[model samples]
Target: MSGSTATTTPQTTIRIPAPAVTALRDALLRPDGRERVAFGYCSRSGNDLLLTEVEQVPDENHRHSSPGSCRPTTACEREFISRCTSRDLHPVFFHSHPFTDTAWFSTLDRQLIDRFRKWLTTLYPDRDLLFGVLGHEEMRIERVTADDSRPVAVDIKGEWELEQPVRPTHTAAPDAPAVDTERFDRHLRAFGEAGQTKLANTHVAVVGCGGIGSILAQTLARLGIGKLTLIDPDEIEVSNLPRLPGCTHGDVGQLKVSAMHQRCWEANPDCDIISIARPVQETEDYLKNADIIVAGVDRVTARYWVNQFAVRHLIPYVDAGTVIETSDADPPQIESMEVYIQTIVPGVTACFDCLDRGDPDQAYRESLDSAEEKAAVERGYIDADIEPEPAVIDLNQLAAAHTVSAVKRLALGTQPPVAFRKYDDVSGDQALLETHPNASCPTCLGNSLALGDSTISSAADQEIATAPLDDAALANPLEQTDRTTRDWFPPAVTAFFASDLAQHPTTDP
Candidate 1:
């Protein structure tokens, strides 16, 4: 697994978490050589296709393999199938090209898939075995059928509790470029095929769904960025409607990502959008494949994390926000209004954190984590929340538009480095930051390690997802996972919880 790089999958994608793949790699790449494992978890999402959760089964004894081949021993096979029967999961066969960088279903592999698929599908005919091949530098996964193998593009999601994302997974065929030149006729005239293909193939990670974020998402969707990974933890509140598109009065209390997802799909149905209703800290893996990360978040701590990740992974990052300060001296006049957009390219430009390194005020504000700061307050460290800045849709839109323009130009290879920019509302002045990277700066200097070489430990630990023991789940390629966790829940289960709560109202008799 490596850092984020945007990619597209046709119809099927098997997503494994970074840690599971790391663990699997550690096991398979032991000083001893080639191995096979009844390794992962299996859960079905939609009726025919969606796989909401596919994890590495976390059992140690459930594997066997010999040196040049990955076929499981007869005893391990039967034991794995029996375990899957008990666990109630579908299984996928997982292995690797140990001796080489390129791996595929050799005649032996196809035979193994055929035999293993028959062994289980004979009992549960509706199930088929999905096989995956991991190589030294790349990986591929496919759904195997009786006569043909359909490549199930491999993806990795979860809180990336490791140095980088799971290794990049390559599929056989990516989607054809959008041929509706008539739709983008005007844009075609402006940027041409090189620009068109770049936009079509690029993935942008949107890190918020607030005023600026919402606008950015909608605008980018309309512009046809091929894939979008939208991350935000807030739900739609009544106040959000005034500033965010795709947010209605009816959307109140629903996840912001939900609204963004619906809006993105509506704008461009052909685009692939994955909505993660969580903060960037919890879902950094999504950023692993993102070509550009557009952040519209309000929290400085979260932004700091993004800054660190972007530099560490060598991903381009852009963040922008708007603010209005009002004075209550008699008439409550607007004191100052401003918006800023900052762009950071790992080795090319100054890092966002550099701005805070010299100033105590800025550094303090950047260091504050609302939740952690709240805890600190209880321990008597801080006195107040960050001052609330009024937001206007107009201001938000302006900031988003400028950032979007910068992105479009950058993608088309025409924009210069504008590390930071400020627009003054009162004076109607635009300012560009001209600071150079500090020679000793951590993000872009000589000491800054290249992508994936940073020895920093993870911000969080990988929580093992618990699933029941199923024969099919045991036979899968990756690992087992249940969607019914405190942080993540399937829609059906969410609805059930709501209904259950309503029915079991606490009555004081």
Candidate 2:
């Protein structure tokens, strides 16, 4: 378990929030040198399972306890199973082998798991049963089956030190490269060969395929990222030709994602690129599997939705935008031209809500129907035709580069990305500012943080649509999420992302 670096291609992965992992580690790896057990209730999102809650079995609840083996009382097991049933969550059992160097199930473990799996599956026939073992060197999880078991990668979100499961055979070797060493010779130096392989395994989702987003897609492809998911509901326009990479007059009227997909393919033929010609709100299933989200959107509502999704799923988010202000006069005199970049590491750094960047007025207007919007415009409540924001290619490229650099840090496990970066286009000056999570922020704290698919659904979007955006909402943009709770599915519930599972999922595992 403790060896040189390696890479894995596990089909199943379990994403645990930082706090839950910390709690489990502390409880299972006790100083007493005795075996300990904990149970995690998981929520499924595509092939990835998210640990929503952890329950540590106390010493009093153990029937037998020793350094080599331990067993939870039948009553204790039933109690936790009851909790899982109440919440309609899947159960994953974890235990520690304090005396062992590598983690593996013992004979006692096989007996206990067989007994528990039989009892649990009878109650929930379709659900998968998983067992985890934490040894002195590493932790491993396997899905229990009638005949045998298969490895399930354990990914700790918000904590980079703990590892994603690496395939037993693939170790780090700079001289022996998996990718085109000549094409990425420069990359291997900055990121070691293992890091280069990590890039080849990372999946990034670009939420807006306009301006900066188009640049991000092409750049990431050129950087040898293994997968890219491009999402946007817009088609190309004549005016967009200047900002969109690889777009020409002939490509006008085509979907932005399609254009970017073709452009990215030309950049890296080996990289897998998925094009979704729809709003990010309609593409939550795809977003769930993304290793990182790069949002370069201008709409407040779109940004809000992306931020909420990232926070709820504990995915790293890079939100970048350009701001151009002009003074109102006979001629509009330029006031400021700047770009801002925020790297949101859920449960660790500040989120979109922590910065209070949402515009309630715009979001409310966007939610209005055609008739209601026309009435409001006629009543002078809102503008009938809002002028488009000014944009320039140089500013877009600058923002895209900064955003990609943030993703590079996350992919390579080098260091924490900068919390916030600001560049003055006119002054040619840049600054990196530090930011902390807001204790009261609903998006990244107190709620939604690591809630995973529990916080998302078609119903959740309806909540965002119907939320009251009055003075109270203006004070806190995401306060409306308080009303968007999703009920856990019934025993026979269908997979929410079942329809979209045909496409390739993220390759982080």
Candidate 3:
């Protein structure tokens, strides 16, 4: 279906739920001599589009055009108009080619598409028609504008049964031409040709860039995600080298998002990486538009916000964390090291809030969002926590690996939508348990707009020009209030603090 338009050449991202895509592909796949076409409706989210449902024009309702022209039977035509024309839903038409591996529109095919658009205009004059050719193990999508056809990235959330192409198409452009299949040959055996395509089209957004987030980004790149968005505000430190893959001593002071963005690009030059050096809260649009969100933030509040935001946007989410607990026994033995991965499919699975709702620590977790609150905990003002939890690279890596796998499975619909996968190091125990949605959960209840929110725009407004990471802190944040500040105080209030602290600071001696 159609949605709002953006800049012309680079078409908007098309988001289809994983299953919807699988259904569409299955419906379109056919014998070489036979013919078929599939159509569907989709809602919009900002500049991006989505595929909401698909229905095949039954064989009885359409004529086969094997090596020839084909048209819908009168009955099929009438049904299409009745169900789709009046609503302004964008109509996507798919047809198969006799040959496999690759596909291109012929002169007759072009004429047919033009005629179809003309017929569509009689029903909805302003509607734009979308077209696809299901070639051998491959698919090509185009936006038929009044002037020309524009290519758009078709991002399917979760996983899809790929079209087993007769062979891998030359999936590259001339200017940027390079060998594409050699690197993924190993992957092809596991996911098959179709799965690799699905992986290539998946758009994943990672909300943190620390140990867990960095590992997740790298793994997703290696997994063949075509596009990735990284959202984080922290910079790398010497201490980060222990766990973050691809981050070396040379990158010690770079922005975590920027460094990891480079690492992913170097891994898969085919993938488009959008690096946002900012907190997820400041950049909600990325989370909303991504096919899936991999939550890797350190703060509980950030995770809480991501769950709600993801639910509101109907995006799949994978969140994970690791904790190490030790006992004050005679030998001060390591009591346990636990890693947990939580995956959620909005409206389908139990969201993070649903799980937190039943836990007594929810209130405490909710309150620990602020730097001051964290400082208080470190100072023992909060009794529940002795201090900040220690971060280990191996633990973060273990949890990230599981979370990334879950992220892939969530997109593929192979795993339970709401499940907690836990690993205990000391006890050598592993469990994956299904989680139930809260009966009174508001988000699950308010599934009024499934892929219907187009008001939230991308991060253009929230985007800050990403600068190369400086070795030093660059400037005191208090001193650079005019340049940047998220200090939780108004400028005037900060001024008051400056004066108050200055007046009382002689006691520091």
Residue 21 of model 2, lDDT score: 67
TM-score of 3: 0.57
For model 3, how does the per-residue alpha-carbon lDDT over 1-509 read when each residue is reduced to its tens digit?
22112122345656555555567667766654455777776555667666656887777767655544455676776666555544535677777664544556668778887877666655565555788765555556676765666666665443422343121122222122232678988988777765677677678999898989998999899888878999988889887788788778999888998999899999888988999987688887666667788877767768877887776566778888887888778765677999988887654457787776323354465566678677866787666554656678888888888887886676554444437888997799999877656767755444432435433222331122222333222332255344445565465654455432321111221
Total backbone collisions, model 2: 1
Whole-model lDDT, candidate 1? Answer: 0.65
Error of 2 at 454 (Å): 4.6
Using TM-score as the measure, the top candidate is 2
Per-candidate TM equals 0.54, 0.81, 0.57
lDDT of 2 by residue, 434-461 (tens): 8777998977776676666553323334
Off-target runs (Cα >4 Å) in candidate 3 are 1-44, 48-179, 357-386, 411-418, 446-509
Whose TM-score is higher: candidate 1's or candidate 2's? 2
Q: Write the residue-wise lDDT of candidate 1 on 339-405 in tens digits.
A: 8888775545577766652344545656767787778778876665555568889899998997887
Number of the predicted model whose lDDT against the real structure is largest:
2
Report how far residue 26 has shifted in candidate 2, in Å.
1.7
Q: Which stretches of candidate 2 lie over 4 Å from their true place?
A: 1-9, 161-177, 426-439, 454-509
